[model samples]
Structure formats: C-alpha cells, structure tokens
Target: MTTAVDTRQVRDLAVAALAWVSAHRGDFALGADALTADGPVDLTWKPLGELAQTCVSVRRCTPPSDPLHACASDLLDFAWQQTGRGELFLRLQRTEPFATYPLEVYSVFAGAGLRHTGYEVAAGAVARSRGWRLTEHEPTRRLGLLNAERRSGIHRPERFAQALGRTWLGGLPEPWTFERTSGYALTHVVFHLTDWGRTAQDVPAELAAYLTDWLPPWLDTCLDAGMWDLACELLIVAASLPQPIDAATLQDPWRRIARVQHASGALPLMASDPARTHEADPEPSFVHGYHSTLMLAFAAALTQGVPV
Candidate 1:
C-alpha cells in the first residue's frame, strides 16, 4: 500500500528521474540508468563501471500526444532534485532550477497547465533535501558517487557545450563557465533559489537587495555569446525563491541574444577556458563561485553594497 508520502514521492521521483535523464542524456547513459522498455531503473550519481552495473528492463516513458522526448514536470523535478541534491543541482543546472524548468520546460508541457503538478513535486523533493531536520553535510554523500571526470565529469563547467555558426564570423564556441569570475553571480542565484525560510529576514535588507540587482550579469555573460536557457532558468529560480528583482532582469539574457542579429544560429553554451580553474580541481571550484559570491555580496550589500 502506498502511503500519502510514498505516493507523492513516486510521482515526484518519476518527474525527477525523467528530468535527470533528459538533461543528462550522456550521464544517464554513463550511469546506465536511462529508462527504456525495461522494468524499474536503478540510478546513482556515479557511473557504473563494474560493481555499479545492474540488470534491468527498459520502458519508453512518454506520452502519445507529445513528440518531445522530455517533459517540463520532469525538468522541474530535476531542478528541484538538483537543489535537493545540493551541489549536484548546482552542477546540473549550471544556473538555477526555477530559471531552467518552468521557463524553458514549458515547451514539453505543450502549453498545457502544468502549474499544480510541477509545484507539488518540486516542493516535496526540495523539502526532503533541504529540510532542517537533515544535517548540512547530508548532500556530500552524493560526492561518493562522483566520477573521475569531474574535470571532464558532468560536474565540470561546459559539460553542455554547443558549437554553432555565426553570421559574419561563421563558427564560434559558446562556453558556460569562467573559473573564478562567475562565483558572485552563481552564488547570488543559488542563495536566492534556496529556502532561507523566514530567516532570510535575518540576512539584512541591503545584502538581500544586491542579490536582486547583481544577478543581471549572469543573464549577460558575454555580449555576443549568450545563454537564454540559463537566463530563463535563473529567472524561474529567482521568481520561485521570490527575490527582489522583477521579470525585467530575465529579459536581459534573451534580449541580448535576440538583438545580436546573427545570420547563423546563436551558439549558447557554458563558458570554458582550459587555462582557468573550474576544470582543474573540481572540488575547490564546484560551487565556490556561487558560495563566495553569496557571502561577499551579502557583506557588500549589507555594508558597502558595491559590486567590488
């Protein structure tokens, strides 16, 4: 018999597993957790080399009316699960959950009202992960399942690199991350996306306000290179977290991309510079950008309130 919580968890995990699979088609395959016409799928954050492998049935989980391989609810679940999974969510989203799922995943919903289902699942998943009852260190266990390529791993910046042609120039690369530079922006997004509960009030008004305005940069990564998917996700996350910034900030990322007037399709992907860090030692820089930014921004917003 399914308890209310158990029933909710299955539905929630169903969506989470779906989003996890789609967003990380490569990782899911590496982990061999991709859902096929088989039975139940077993998954871990790590790749199954030998002991990790498991036999399973495959099943195609899809809707007949929907041709899109992925769904919004699953993406939403993925975002929520990432947040719940803490750093995994940070690594996976590369921006923020709320920004990614509701804003971008709507295409999967096919214009249907996905409001209730998505919200319910997202809230449930996060509560489990971020709940006060759980210790802060709880998420580190996922680190155990991590693969060696954290440099080249899914956690590495630019795991989702896209190469496309530009109008005059022909071809260009759009990278997703910058070693030490993106920390402030990343943390601001993560802090806002978190459930600070009523305690956010304890964080001070000035610091809170900076988190609002300072986020515009993540939306404006580079003038020519752009990432609306990440921007929308940042926006969705901002809205879900109920930040001070308005939807106007969300428009900046898309606006920049739209205004570019590129003859070829815009190449929107993670930032990458092999010389810089995020890839060298995944441990030091993983969420360091966001973490440091949040702390510094809070201090500045509270005391100085300057970009520094």
Candidate 2:
C-alpha cells in the first residue's frame, strides 16, 4: 500500500520557497550595463524573466485564498516595476529591433495583464519585419519565441505542431537515450506546449502517454542522484501530465527534497552526497539556489491540483 504525501508539508515548502524569493527580490535587478549594446542579457535579463515566469505559474496554480497566490502577485509586481512598468522593454526593443529577448521577457508580464501599449506596438512592428522573421534560434528556443508571440498578441505564422515536430521531444526519441541536456530540452518542450502547466491537456496524447510511462523512473533516478534542480523540474512535469502520477508515488521524492532544502528555503544545484542527507547551508549562493528554489515552489503549487 502507498502512503499519502503530507499535504501540509508540501504547502509549507511552497510558502517557505516564496518567502526566500521575496527576501531576495532585489538581487533580480538588472546591472547598470544591462541596456548597453554588449549587454549581458543572458545573465541579467534571463533571471528576471524566469522570476516573472515562475511567479506567473505560482499565481495561476494557487487560489486567491492561498498565501502563495499573494506572494506570487507581489513578485510579479516587483518584476514589472523593475522593468519600469515596461518602459525599459520599449527602449530595449527600439535599440535592438531584431533582438528576441526583450519581447520574450515582456511577454511574461503581458500575459499576466501588466502590459505596456508602447512596447506592444513596437514589438508588433518588429514582428512584421523581414529581419525578425528570418532570425534563427534553436528548436526549443524557437518554440518559446512562437509562444511569446502568441501571448503578446503578435501573429504566429508557424503552427505549434510544426514547431513541436522540430524539437527532440516531439520526435519521441528513445527513452534510454535521455541525458542531462535532453532532459532539460524535453521539459521545456512540455512547458512551452502547455504554458507552464496551465493547460496540461495541450500536451499531445502520445507525448503524455510516453511521459506517464517513463517519468516515474526518471524522477526516481534524479532524486536518487540528488539532482535537486532538475528533479524539481521533473516534479513539475509529472504534475503537468494528463493523468498525473499518484501523489503516493511522490511522497518519498518530496521528502528527499525537503531534507536538502535550507531553512531559508534555498536548494543547492545538487546535493554533495545522495546517500546522506546533508545539513542546509547557512548561506547558499543566490546564483546556485535561485532557479531550483523557484522550481520547487512551482512544483509544490502544481501538486495542489492547480494544473488541469
């Protein structure tokens, strides 16, 4: 017989994780050189965008009565204000008309109803340009861009199915061939297809079936390896499946993550030893813990029956 997962403990984990993010919201600020031509958009902009994206997921998954919903809303407000209520996005789009990062980042806020008409108009114009249309991206990234376009009210000429077909996951590669890189890629393919689990039914039937069959073992391996960050993501993917895996099956995995999570709610990139539960670090690096912590909260929120 399977033991039931502790619902209260899962909710507490989500609460603590969001608390950590709120305390470190200042760290998500862009550097002074962020707006420059040679800006480190990947470093500065990507983190902030991911923050907003994850906040959106949290907010969407939790009910208004839930503290997590309020926490996520606050974070989204902070992220939008950081972009100067979208003024910075308009400027970045103007300066780099062909750049896709600005639009992609802006799309997260826009989808949450924190829009800037000026940025929208500018992005729309750029979307119609030949240069923008011809810009190249890796298949997974291309899927994200197309989804961003659709979110921001821009035209999406490419069919989602066509985009999916171009991805490694869409091809339904051999399960045995799964590795670190492919693992991340396939998770994203599912995320982009389902809008971070808001629409789990959006996942193709075949893909959902494949994940249902293989995800449990993969999640087990990740937890066993103490790959906390990737394991959190896989947890989210598990919750996103059409027929989500039994909560009883996840009791052990959740307990494993809880044991490694710092008192402040940060998670290291990986545990030092999978065989032993290590003490939480007194001071964890923000760079190492941020993504994993956010993913943990997101997964926890999804576990509360947020995803349809």
Candidate 3:
C-alpha cells in the first residue's frame, strides 16, 4: 500500500540543493573567453548542456513564492545568454560522440525554458538548418529532431505522430542489463511522449501502463545497487506517467537520497564511503552530483505540480 510522502522534507531538500547550485554557479559557468558582445558564446558545449538542464530542472521544480525560483530564473538567463546564440557556433565546431548530445540538450533546455519562463532565444536559420541536416544525416536521432521541432513551435505533428507510432517502450533493455544508455533513452522517450509533461494525453496509454507496472521494481533495483543517477531518472519517468505513481512508493528512495546528500547540498554519485572523500576532492564534485540532484529537484517539482 502506498503511504504519504513527506512533502515538507522534499521541499527542504530541494531548496537546499538549489542553494548549493546557486553558490557554485561559477564552477559550472563557461570560461571567460566564451563570452562575446553578441552574448556569451564559444562555450564548452557538454558542461553548458549539463548546466542548462540543471537550470531547467530547478526552474520546473520551484515556485515563485519559493526562494529558489528567482535563483533558477537567473541561472537560466545566465545559461541562455551564454549559449543560446552559440547554438550554430557550437554546431560548426562539433566533434563525434559529443555532437548530438549538445544539440539535444540545448533543445530541451531552450524549449523548457520558453515553456516555463516565456524566455525566448532565437536559434536562427542556421541552427534550424543544422537541425534538419542532423536529422536527415542521423536517422537514429529522430527523437532529438522532434524535440527541437516541438520546442521551437515548428509544428511538424505528422512527423512526431509517425515517430510515436513506431516507438517500442517494451523493446528497451531492462535498466539493470543495459545500465546508462537504456535508462537515459527511456527517460528521453518519456520526456518526448509527455512533452515534458505539458500534455498528459501525449503519453500513450500502453507506454504509460508499462511504466506504471515496471517502474517501481526498476527503481528499487537501482536504489538497491546505489545507482543514484539511474534511480533519479526512474523517478522522473514515474512522475511523468499519465497515472502517476504513488508518492509513497517514492518515499524511501527520496529519503535515502536526502540522507546521502552532503551538507554542501551535493549528492554523491552513489552511496559512498566517507573515507573516500578524504582521498579525493574534499567536497563531492559537481560532475558527480549534478544529474541526480537536478533530477531530484525535477521529481519534486513534477510530483507536487509547482507552478511553472
């Protein structure tokens, strides 16, 4: 049976995590050389992508009344100013393996930022052309292309609908076996299906049912193994379902993660031995904690329906 989630506790944790991110924003910022008269540009795309997503997550999870709301908004503005105009700039210098990730990240962040904050940054004709070229040249990136379309309000419904018809949620490998790739792919699929949960009907009934049934066990397995990042992503999937998972089902993982969060507000990549921190960086590295903390904030925001 499901029980009640301690919402106050969840809010406190999110606020703390947001505070930690606010304090460390510079650590996540692009180098000084990346800034330009037009705005910040020439960013290191990967970290900027991560930071963008982090800003979106926090923004989605906090409310105007909440103190973190202003901070999230500021950080997002900072991120957009730094990288928004640079979409085409980064594309020009793109390298393999990292190529598609930055585009997808920028699209997700830009789209969600617009949705939540009414903040607009034009990707321009060059970026649009780049998206089409990437889509045509990289057939596997159909989802990313759709995301870019949806965010930019380009309205290619037929293409998105066609892609949805072919999606096979059950065909995905179990989280335990495929680990990182499988987990990330599933999260992306859900994000697209729900349009980041803006349209509940967009989530197909079959996919929603599959997640409703499987997510609990999958979440437990990841938590048991101390895969905090995957566990957090699973929580996001659970939050996005049409029939939302019971908050009680998420309570244990939430509390465990909260417990493991360092006083600095950064969560370790896994449940770590205290002795290990002494040997490495004194604080949990931002890279180590970013996704999990960001997702935790997202889960709290989505589950609670904090006003965008």
Top candidate (lDDT): 2
lDDT per residue, candidate 1, 112-193, as tens digits? 2223334334423433343412323212111211111121112323111111011111121122343223432343323222
lDDT by residue for model 3 over 75-108, one digit each (tens)? 7777666654545435333322223344465565
- Return the TM-score for each candidate structure: 0.29, 0.94, 0.75
Per-candidate RMSD vs. true structure?
Answer: 19.5, 2.0, 5.8
Instruction: List residue ranges in candidate 2 displaced over 4 A.
Output: 1-3, 274-283
| Residue 237 of model 1, lDDT score | 30
Q: Model 1 shows how many backbone clashes?
A: 27
Q: Candidate 3: list runs displaced more than 4 Å.
A: 1-3, 32-43, 84-109, 112-141, 155-158, 164-178, 272-282, 306-308
- Candidate order by TM-score, highest to lowest? 2, 3, 1
Give the alpha carbon lDDT tens digit for every residue of 1-308 in model 2: 12377777888888888899899998898877778878988778988998999999998877798778998999999898889999999888878888889989999998898899999999999898888887888899999999899889999577899989999889988888887788888889888888888888899899999888888888888877778889999989988877787777788888888888899988887777667644454446888889999899999888865422
Residue-level lDDT for 270 in candidate 3: 66
**lDDT of model 2, residue 234:** 92
* Local error of candidate 3 at residue 162 (angstroms): 3.8
lDDT of each: 0.27, 0.85, 0.60
